[model samples]
Every structure is written in structure tokens, then in C-alpha cells.
Target: MEELDVNVSSSEAFGIAEKIVLLSFISAVILMAILGNLLVMVAVCRDRQLRKIKTNYFIVSLAFADLLVSVLVMPFGAMELVQDNWIYGEMFCLVRTSLDVLLTTASILHLCCISLDRYYAICCQPLVYRNKMTPLRIALMLGGCWIIPTFISFLPIMQGWNSIGIIDLIQQRQFNKASNSTYCIFMVNKPYAITCSVVAFYIPFLLMVLAYHRIYVTARAHARQIRLLQRAGNPAEPRQGHQEPRQDHQEPRQGHQEPRQGHQEPRQHPPDQHSTHRMKTETKAAKTLCIIMGCFCLCWAPFFVTNIVDPFINYTVPGKLWTAFLWLGYINSGLNPFLYAFLNKAFRRAFLIILCCGDERYRRPSILGQTVPCSTTTINGSTHVLSFFFCQRRGGGPAAPGLAGQRNQRGCAKVPGGVGEGNALFPQSPG
Candidate 1:
């Protein structure tokens, strides 16, 4: 009898150690997620350059959504995971589940909105993009990102719409449980699973994929144009036969003018330097955003796939697996801020400035002083310009009479200078 008692105590100690390990890991994740998302929100709010770009508005919204996920959704999830049972009553359980669904769906939708915003800015005409992505329109899209998840999350879960066919099975499990402790079982029927997964994951995934694909194509075309311009500007050799008698006689005059022209022309028409740098920056920003999207998809896809498949398989998926997938999705909330800091120079600077308690060295120089008036209008005290690539003329000069029309008659609307540099998502340079 003493031997049996000793063995039981040893097993209990082992179980307690396991629980401690689980709780510690989960607590760390929760803390990181909360702090990281808070940093993103504060960085965007404080950084002048980040505020100037309209795309960062969507990013701020995304960060806010992730922040809510960390604050509202993660702690309860961690508690339930550590305890291995839902001590909270049925009403609170439903509320927690609803919040879980609502916040995650909103986060995903923000990503889709961001992709669409980029597509419109990069692929459409400047005027068209400006008209389409007005402040009011942006507000509406941001509002929809927050509001559209309710139908799948709170309304259905609260009204008992998710357990339509599984009511009996759920009751049976509750009755047959070995312990009397309550469980927050969020089992769904096939229809609910399909509808929820479709709304929350699949549709937004499709939209994001499509938008990024178009942005990629447009970026590739712009790159090709830059390459062609470089090759034309720098030829292998001068053709002796093509030189006319006028060229031979005027050679000395041209030679005398060459030194002055060479100094001024580079600043005016620096397609090789300015244009190529701008394209490279834009391409890099796009690639970074794509990496973000890929991470989001990777984290959420497993849980959502299982969410849809579990009901069809009669809910045979193990409880541990469900918990693992759910926490994996939660980890994404913490990953975004790290990804931004590592991948984006602007974000990194802003983060450093914030973390260092407003250190001057980490702060980026203000670009507002260099702002040139172009095809942009101020709305609500914020300058909204969609055409980063479009320039007025070389050296910020006004276009000649009928020059705009002639360029419009041809296919080229964007010149090589005058407007801001780089893409809408990032600043012109690291500073």
C-alpha cells in the first residue's frame, strides 16, 4: 500500500511539472503578442512618414485587430489550455468563442483590404486610383473589415446556429464525460463549418491572392520598362556611318557644350539611378508584404482546414490537435510586428524610436519639407496621392503646352521625376 501511494505521488509531481511547462510557454506567447502589437500601433501613430502614407492606415487597422486578438482572445485560450477544461459557464463560453471568431476574421479581412489597396494604387491609373480610394471609401473599407465578421461569429454562435445537427452528439458527450467539470465545446455541424470557413478564410484568401498577382504583373512590366530605358541610354558603340556631314562640322561645338550638358542632364534625366532605385524599392516592399501574407496563410490554414474537415469526419480529430492548431494561429498575432521590423526599414526605424523612448538618432528625417505639389489634393488635412511613379517633368519643371496631351496620346503617363519616390507602403529611403 505504501509503494502504491509513493508511485501515485511521483506521477502527480510529473503531471504538475508538465502543466508548469505548458503554462509558462503560453504566458510567454501571450505577453509577446500583446507587446508587439502595441508597438506597431504606437509606431504608426508617432511616425510622421508612416502617417503620410495611406496604406499604413490599413496596416494600423490590422495591428489594432491583432492587438484585440492578443488581449481578448489569447488569455482565455491559454487558461483553457492549461486547465484542460472550461470552468466558465455556457454563456461566457459562447461569448469567448464569438470574440475569437470575430477578431481573427477581422484580422484576415484587413490583410485582404491591404492587398486590394495596393493593387489599385499600383495597377490602375492615378486619377482612377485616387477617385476610387478616397478617404470616405477607405473609411468604409476599414469599417467593413471590422463589421463583416459578426454574421459568422457572434450572431450564429450566440443564437445556437452552429450546433444544428450536432445538438444530440454534444449533449451526449457532455453527459458521458467522466468528470463533472464543464467544457466549452465549440463543435459545429457540416453546414456551419463550411459556411464559417468559407467566409472567414477561403474568400479573403482568394481575393488577396488575386490582388497580389496583379500587383506582381504590373511591377514586372514597370521593371521591364526600366531595363529598356537603361539599355537605350547606354549603347555599345557609336556608328560611324550614321554620322552626317552636319555632325562632323558641329562636332567641336557639341564637344564644347558636352561638359556643361553632362553635369545638368544627369540630375534631370537620371533614369538609370532614380527610376531603377524606385522600382527596386517598390519590388522589395511588395515581396515583404507577400511574405507577411504567406506567414498568415501558413498559420491559419491548418486550423481552418481542420475546422471544416472535423465535422465531416464525425469529429474524430483529437483535442490536443485542435488546441495545437488554435495556438498556432494565435502565434501569428505575435509574428507580424517582428516581421515588419525585420523586413521593413521604415518600420524598423519607427520601432527603434519608440522602444528607445524617443531617441533622436533612431528618428527618421522629415520628408514633408521636400514635398512638391503635383496631381494631389488634400482631404481631411491629409495629402492623398496614389501615383508615386508619375512625375510632372524633368527637374520638377512644368509640362510644356500640349505635352501632357501628347504623352496621353501615347501610352506613357508617368515621367521619371517630380513625384515622390518608392512605393506607397514605404518611404523613399531608410531615413
Candidate 2:
């Protein structure tokens, strides 16, 4: 075995003042992240309405990461602030770095997924998006993100993790045992950090920037079209002389002037409202994903540069500051729900409905209190059974079911009978 660098001393990279500031920042970030992500998870789990689509599923996955960071990273980080040196053993250091790498990777991948989702949705490629972005596919991507890096992280520990073969910790314990004090693992190698940044940060980053740029271009086109249409008409009287050829009018609505009357019957198209909403949603969601990606890059970029570039430059900075910045990137997991609500109508509606579920209407007298969506599954053999629970609107007044929106998992609005309210007999996508 290689001799341990136990006695190798590293210069103190952080002062007490810097440590205090970093601790404060990360502590604030950790607390907010925990609450935000917990709210998202609870709302999704309690309300059946949030799980109807791929986007919400991704949101939940991100929340899971945030919860993990809060549980696993924050406390250790706080303790480390007080004790500048690692009191915890090599094992914990390894685990810490591994989890940090994996979770951050997953979060970045989520942002990328969201950007792709937005692109397809806004670009009118629903079938392609739906076919490609399955839950199983997402699960595999997440698995790959975790398993691959963890394998890489443990590679240099004793030997290549692949070469180490299956660890029979059970049997190993029978021989020479590691100390009980070896609970924390942070002794990660530099290769793992560099590789993590490349795969998890740079790749996803470039992809999101490209996707968002395209989305912005497309959205600008749509905005231009909408403006032209708006300018060409009077809500009261239609404008004249600026008309297009008959081929363009498409189902001239029962109202356009007679010149457009004989226009070849415009092709019957899908619902305009639906298409418009989808386009708007995709554009906004893409932008949000880009912003999230930007945040990730900003947080991780400094640490990566410091850690990687410093070796050659022999440059050193405050380790506490760098560590705090790195953890800050993980905060994106908690911000996802807020981003979704801000950028996507479906998510916003889901959040609103879930919030309203606990009201007096549903709680006391009215139709029902606020209710959020949860995943309920009964797996028997090859098939799966899923059901959603609905909560009535908040105001203790009558809820016109129409106002409740489409019922399939998105709405989760149940009538007096088991029947649902909205016309959508099936969810846009299965859970």
C-alpha cells in the first residue's frame, strides 16, 4: 500500500472571518433550500395533480436532491467551519465528495432535460418529446449519473473500483477493521473532480445555452407574428388592404371580410389556445433552465478553476469560500419548483391548486380543502394502477368545475362520484 500523507500539512486557506461569512451564507442557503424543496415534495406527494407530466416528475427528482444536500451536506459543512481540519476519516470524505459529485450532476442534468423539454414543446414536436422523455429513460440517466461517477470516485481508493470487484464489506469486517471513527469520507482524488466538472457542468452547460438561444429565437418569431396579427386587426373592426393570399388565412374564422371569404377553406388546425400556450410555456421554461444552468456554472466554475488550475499555478485561495460556492450550485435543486411555476403554466397551476387544498373550503364545509398530488401505484404483474386525489378550491364558495381545469392527473378534480370533471379522460402522460 502507498504510504499515507497523514503528516502532509496544507496551508490554512481560510481565516476565521472568511469561515464565518461562508458558514453564514451556506447556512442561509441550506435552510431555504431545505424548506423550498420540502414544500415542493410534499405538495407533489399530497396532491395528485402535480405528477401528470414529465416536467413535474423532474421537479420532484430535483427536490429529492435538495433534500439530500440538506440532510447530508449542510451539517457536516457547518461542523467543518468550526473545525478547519477534517476530523472525520477518509471514508466520509470519499462519500461526501461522491454525493456532491452525483447530486450536482443530477441537478445539472435536470436543467438540461427541462431545456430539451421546452425546446420540443415550443417547437411543436410533442410526439417526439413524449416518445423520448419517458420516466424509465430519466431513471436510467439519473442512475448513470450516480453509478458512473461513484465508480470513478472509488477508482483510486485501493485500486480501480471496477478492478476492486464487488466489495464484501460483510467479509472484510471479519478481518482487520477500519476504525469506527471513520464515518466521513472526503479524500477524493483530483481526477474525479475534473471529470465531474466536464461531464456534469461543461457539457450540460453548452447544451442549455444552445437550447435556450434557439428557444429565444423561436419565441421572438412568435412574438413578431402575434404582434403583426394584433396590429392587422381591430377588436371591433377588421383592417383591410394588408390581407394575405387565401392559402394563409386557414379557416378564416366565421368573421373575416368577404375578400377572405372565398379564400380556400383554411386548413383545420389544432386549437390555437393550446398551441399558443405550449409555445409560450416552452419559451419561458427554456429561459428558466438556462438561468438555472448559469447559476450552476457560476457556483461550480470558481471551485473547479481553483482546484484544477491552482495545481499548475500553485495558486491558493480560501478553501471555505470555494467550498461554499460549490455547495451554492446545489441550491438549484430547491429553486426548480419556483422556476417551474414561474415559467410553465401547468406547474404554476399545480402549485396553486396544491396550496389551495388545505383551505377551509376543503377542510371545513365547502367542496374540499386544498389538496396536492401524490403518486399512488399498485403494481401487479406487468400493469400499474394509479389514482389521484382532488381538493376543492379555497374560497368557501361554489367551485364551477370548469374553473378547476382539466381533471386527468393535472387537475385531479373529482366529482361527487368517482368520475373526474375535465374532459381529458386520460392524463397527457402516464405517471
Candidate 3:
């Protein structure tokens, strides 16, 4: 393909009103991405419920990556937008561009890791997920998420492999030499562009879509099995029958007090019924996360698609149109925190308290033991107390006897025995 010459021109000076609107828009996006993601980090760190769930590690990591993009990448992009020229010299330009690639790619990679986590959580055996996704393992994955993108961005751009070959290298060198160059853009040839598109966007996008589809399929199959079990008659009654003895045996083996064992361990949920209930919960969560991944794809697809095509088209795309798509990509960072707030009850309440500087609704427990101001949200008419990554039932289905006495300030009631009488099902909190 012949190199298409683009006539670059300085943007016309904006009127005061236009300038104000542009600055306000940029500021809003920057603030939302920064503050929203920051709150997510805070919630994960501070909230006992969120901290207990291992899956939330992925959420925290994702939020951190988005925070970096908001702080490091978006501000520089904003500066370029306002100035209409690369006032910052070459070293800073390289740094900004590298950080942009590093953080955005890290964000996408974190989403991929989350999808993998959800896939295993939903599709595999509970024990399998428990054994596989340890904290050390997750930390390793997070490390790679940052490391791989940094290598790709810095090595190629700095070493000039992204431009490739003699002619393209000469073009990049001459463009750098031009002290009057107005725009900050990374020039790349077909190989580097195509390779990066595959690694950063296309491959991750496909994997995420496929993972979500599999999760949906598995969830539907589980739902169907539950329906069949329900039709076959009350599977729960006998399952509950068996459940009592198991808890009875486990409690005594673990040295629960004799009096407490009888009071706590005997209470049982219909095992099949609770299993079905849990399946529904997992399915609902999978759907919500899939929707988030879909939104991310929608926001970023245009830019990555154009990113690859631009090189092949000899960079023919208009600068303004390219800028629009780039900003559209940035919109995903701003959208993620809001998505968490909208979908999850805990996040919404946390956001409200954090943003409002404390609301009266979140009152501390009184001496006589008042309501701890649990973060409850109305979902399909029923109230959901979103404590962690899982949808905790308001009353965790027939509370054990010891629970009433053991209720904590955050509304986490400790039930005796290994049985999770009033707790989230997977990875029951230690007594």
C-alpha cells in the first residue's frame, strides 16, 4: 500500500464557552475514573466482607489498573487535547505513550483474568477453584498483567521495532527530528500494529467472549438440572436429612462444645434446594460480569480495530476521527467504577458514603445492638444484601442457633459448625 499523506493542521482557537465545555468534559471523565476506581480499592481494603472473598482480588486489581490509566494516561491525553500540540518534549511523549499502552493493556488483561476466574468459579467443582486460585496464584497473575504490557509497549516503541524496516525507521527518525511537530502519535508498521492488535485487543476480546458464552451455557445446564431435580420431587428433604449428620459429625470432630453442637449443627437447609439457590446466584453473578465485559468490548472495539487498520491503510484516517475513537476507548476506564456501583449493592452504598462524606443511613451499631446499616438494594422487588462478590441471602436460609449471639458490627453473624448457616456458600468464613 502506498503511504497516504495526511495534511495535519492546527485546531482553530476555541471560544471561551467551547473551551469551558471541553475542559469540563475532560475533567469529569478524569475525576470519575480516578475517584470511582479509588473507592473500589478503598472498599476492597476496608470492607471485611469484600476482603474475605478471594474473587474480589481480581476486582481490586482491575480497579488499580484503571486508576493508573485515569491518573497517568488520561491527564496527559487531556493536556494534548487542550493544547492541540505536543508541548511536552520527546522523552515525556515516549513516557506518556508507553504508560498509555501499559495501563490500558493491563486493564484489558485484568478483565481477561477476571473472566477466567469466573469461568472456573462457575464451571468447575468448588474444591477445584479453591485449590487452583490461591492468593499467591492471583498475585502472580496480577504481576504478569503489569509486566507483559510494559514490555510490549516500552520495548517496541523505544527500540523502534514498531516502525520496522529502513524507510519506516527513517520516517520516524525524521518525524522526531522535526522540532515543530504538533501531534503526539506513535508510528507503527503493519507487523507491529497487527501483532499488538492481536495481543492487546483481539485475542483478549475473543477469549472473554468465549469464556462468557461457556459460563452462560454451563449455568443454563445447571439450571436445567435443578429443574429436573425439582420435578422429581423434594430432593432437598433427604439431602437435608443427610446434611444434618454430616454437620453433626464434622462439628464434634472439630471440637465444637457439646451444648453448642446440638443447638448449631442440627439446623439444616434442604441441600438440593440450597444447591439450586446457589446455582441461581452464581448464574446471576456470571450474567452481570458478562454484561460488564460486553460494555468494555463495546467501548474499546472501535479504537483497536482502527489501530490495526490504520497502519495497513497507510494512516489515512482523519486525526479528529482517530482522536474520537481513542477517547471512546478511554471512556471504559470511567465507566467501570459506575458499573460496579450500579450492579453491586455494596459498591453503591460505599460510593454513596464515600462521595457524600458519610450518610446517616450507614449508622454504627448502638450499645443495645441496633441495625448496622447493612448495604441493601432492591433487586426484582426482593431486597439483596450485597456483602461480597456473592449475593448473600438476607437471612442466610434458616440461621443456626449460635448466630444471634455472635453477630458482629458489620452484620456478619458467626455460626458454629462447618455448616454455613448464615454465610455465603463458597469458602465459608472461619468460626
Candidate 4:
């Protein structure tokens, strides 16, 4: 196949306007990705409720990937958009391209892992999610995603066998003879580039799509089973001969003590009529991750294929065209957090907490139960309160009075945590 001979020329006015637009877009994407993902990281870290769930561990990895992509790739594309060439040194060029490859791979794998998490959560009838999604497994999956792809990206640079390698050997030989030439990051052959594409992009993409499709089918099936169980009769309720335990349990200090603070710990409540709604929320989270992964696949697929596979194919995609695809592929970095804000409640609240308070998390008592020491009040037209719980978690139905200190509990700290009947969830204020 003949190489694309694009002249790559435009009028000064068009170029300047294009640069301004691209620069603005890049800036906004960076701003949102950093702020949004940092919020997520903080929420997952500081909130015990969020950490208890396995799915959030995947969210943490996904946010990290988005943040990494913004820092590693977006700015370079912004600079190249203005200068119309790779002005940075050859080493940076390799690093930029490699980071793009590795982080994108990590992002896709994270989404795939999320799909798996949701699948079992909804599908397995007898097993509880906590029993299914153990801490060690989540940690192992995250570790595998990052550690595995790193070598796939970095080895090319270390061995001097990649694009930089090809250019460097040629440029140096020419320099030994004469000093009038240039050094760039262009690769030499079809096999080398194509191999990188297969390792970094195509295989992971195939896995993500298949994994999500399976997750969707499994979740829907589980939801249908749950609906059936409710319609037939509450499978969870015991026979007429038995009685359910009281909320405070077998306590000697019931008169002087507070009620339990969260969803009854030993699977006390099965999702009921609102099961559909819960399913919908879960589905939306899956969809958001799927969209994010799909966007990443589409954006980078063409560029990688054209860069690597095009050399062997009959159609030679222009360098500029491929570069544009590369930039588009990376656009996902900035788009992820905003997408979460729009689609996921937890993420939106998390974003608000970080942006408004300049911190990742604030601890308070639970909001849903009476035992919580803190009470709600309106301050400056915002619903806020100081909570008593030392650590706040985000998900597991409405918090009992013991754990509602989420993003909504931003500034009003005077409210107490734990029940007045007992000691506050946290120790009394120092002051």
C-alpha cells in the first residue's frame, strides 16, 4: 500500500481558531477529570461504607486511569495541536505514546472487572455480595490490571525496538556523517507496530465488550428472578411460627441504648418492590462504564490499527488522520468524571464534597436512623449537619442514623452523631 501523502496545510486564521478551541477543550477536560476523579478517590478512601463494597475498588482504579491519562497524554496533544509537530524530545514522545497505551488498557480492564462484579452481585441468588466479592480478590484484580500492561508499554522504550528506536538509529548514523538532519518518533516497519497494537488495544477491547454483554444479560435475569420471588411471596420472611429479631438485638441496655445504625447487617432486608429501581441504578453504573470503555475502544482502535496494521493494508490512513484519532481516543480521560456525575449519584455527591470543601471526605453520624448523634439543619439554604460517626460510607440503602454523613453533610457540623441514648459514634468534640 502506498503511504498517505497528506500535505498538511491550512490558513493561519483557521489554524489559530482550531488551536484555541482544542486548547480550551483540553483545559476543561483536564479540570473536570482531575477534580471529579480526585473526588471519587477521596470518597472511596475516606468512606468506610464505600470501601466495604467490592465494586468501588474498581471505581478507584478507573478514576486513577482517567487521572493518569489526563496528566500523561492530554497536554502533549494540546501542545502538538498548536505547534503542528512533536516539539518535545524523542524520549518524551515514547513516554507519551506508551502512557496512552498502558492507561487505556488499564481503563478497559477496570470496566471489565466492574462488569464481573455486577454480574455476581445480581446473578448469584444464595450467596451474598460481600461473601462473593472478597477484599483480596478485588486487590488482586486491580494489581493485575496495572502491573501486567506496564511491561507491554514500557518494554518497547527500554529495548530501543520501538518507533523511537527506529528513528534514533537512523538519525544518529546520519549525524555521524553530517549534522543537517532531524530525529523523530516515527517507526520503521509493519510487524513491530502491529504487534504493539494487538498487545495494547485490540485484545483488551474484545474482552471488555464481551464481558459487558454477559454482565447485562446476567443482571437482567437476576432482576427477573427477584421480581418472581416477591410476587410468589416474600421468600425471606420466616413461617408464621417464627419471629424476626428486634432492631436493637438481645441487648441488656436497650432502655439506655440507641437503635442499630445501618441496613440490618445480617441481610435483614431483601430488596422488594423497589428492587426494579435498585436494578436500574446498578444498570446505569454498568452502562456508564460500558460507554466509557466503548468510547476508549473506538477512539484508539482506528489509530492503532492504522498506525500498526495500515502499513500492511491497502488503505494508508494519513498521519494527521491517525493523529486526530489518537487525540480523540484520549478525550475519554476528561469525559469520564462528568459522565459519572451525570449518571451516578455517589459520584456527583462525591464531586460536590471535594470541590466545595477542599477535602476528600468528612466524617459524621448516619442519617437514616434515630441513634445518630447529629441532627440535620438548614444553613445558608443548604441542608447540612455535623455527624457523629468517625467514618462515613456511601452505599447500602438509606443509612440508619449512624452513617449518613455523605457529601450532603458538607458544613453544618453542630449536629451530633450516634443516639443521644448512647455515646456518640465518634468521641465527643475536643473543644
Show model 1 residue runs off by greater than 4 Å.
1-18, 174-176, 236-269, 339-344, 366-431
- Residue 39 of model 1: what lDDT? 80
- Top candidate (TM-score): 1
Candidate 1 global TM-score: 0.77
In terms of lDDT, the poorest run of 10 residues in model 2 is 417-426
The RMSD of every model to the true structure, in order and in angstroms, is 7.2, 13.3, 11.4, 13.6
Q: What is the C-alpha local distance difference test score of each model?
A: 0.68, 0.48, 0.63, 0.53
| Model 2 stretches astray by more than 4 angstroms | 1-22, 155-193, 234-290, 315-321, 341-357, 360-431
3 against 4, candidate with superior TM-score: 3
Task: Write one digit per residue (lDDT tens) for candidate 4, span 1-431.
Answer: 01222212211123667778877877887787776678778876765555554556777888899888887777776776565545577677777867877887787667667656654543342235456667787788899888867866777655666544245333432221222322233453555676767766677667666655665565455445435434432333554235235534646655444354233322222224334443453455356546766666666677776776555553344545655776776766666555433344444454556567844453343455433222333221111222323223323343442223232233323532211110100011111
TM-score preference between candidates 1 and 4, better one: 1
Residue-pair clashes per candidate, as listed?
0, 27, 0, 26
What's the candidate order when arranged by decreasing TM-score? 1, 3, 4, 2
| Candidate rank order under lDDT | 1, 3, 4, 2
Q: What is the per-residue lDDT of model 3 for residues 1-431, given as tens digits with 9 covering 90 to 100?
A: 22322323323234567767878998998898988898889876765655666656777888998999989898888777676567878788878888888888988888788777756665664557667788889899889888989767988888777766545533443242223445666767888888888888888888888877776676555555445434333324556676776766686554745565455433322333444564566566556656677788788999988988977765777766777788888889888776644455555555566667777685333436633222223221122222321212345653332342222223542211111111121221111
The weakest ten consecutive residues by lDDT in model 4 span 418-427
* Candidate 4: Cα lDDT at 84: 52
> What's the CA error at residue 98 for candidate 1, in Å?
0.8
Task: Show where candidate 4 strays beyond 4 Å.
Answer: 1-14, 125-133, 163-188, 226-296, 339-342, 358-431
- Per-residue lDDT tens digits for candidate 2, residues 1-431, read 11111211211345788778767877777787787777777766765544655555666776777678777866786675555445766567666755666666666676676666555544433346456666788677556645654544444433533212223421222122232222232322345446645776677778777866676665555445434333322222232344445426655553555454333112111122333443454345345545665666676666666655543432233444555565656566556656644344334444565578755433222225534232122111001111112233333344342322222224332222110111111112222
lDDT (10s digit) by residue, model 1, range 221-255: 65665565455443422443575566678988889
Error of 1 at 314 (Å): 1.2
Best by lDDT: 1
Relative to the unseen true structure, what is the C-alpha lDDT of residue 100 in candidate 4, on a scale of 0 to 100? 72
Give the poorly placed runs of model 3, Cα more than 4 Å off: 1-7, 10-20, 166-181, 229-290, 340-342, 352-431
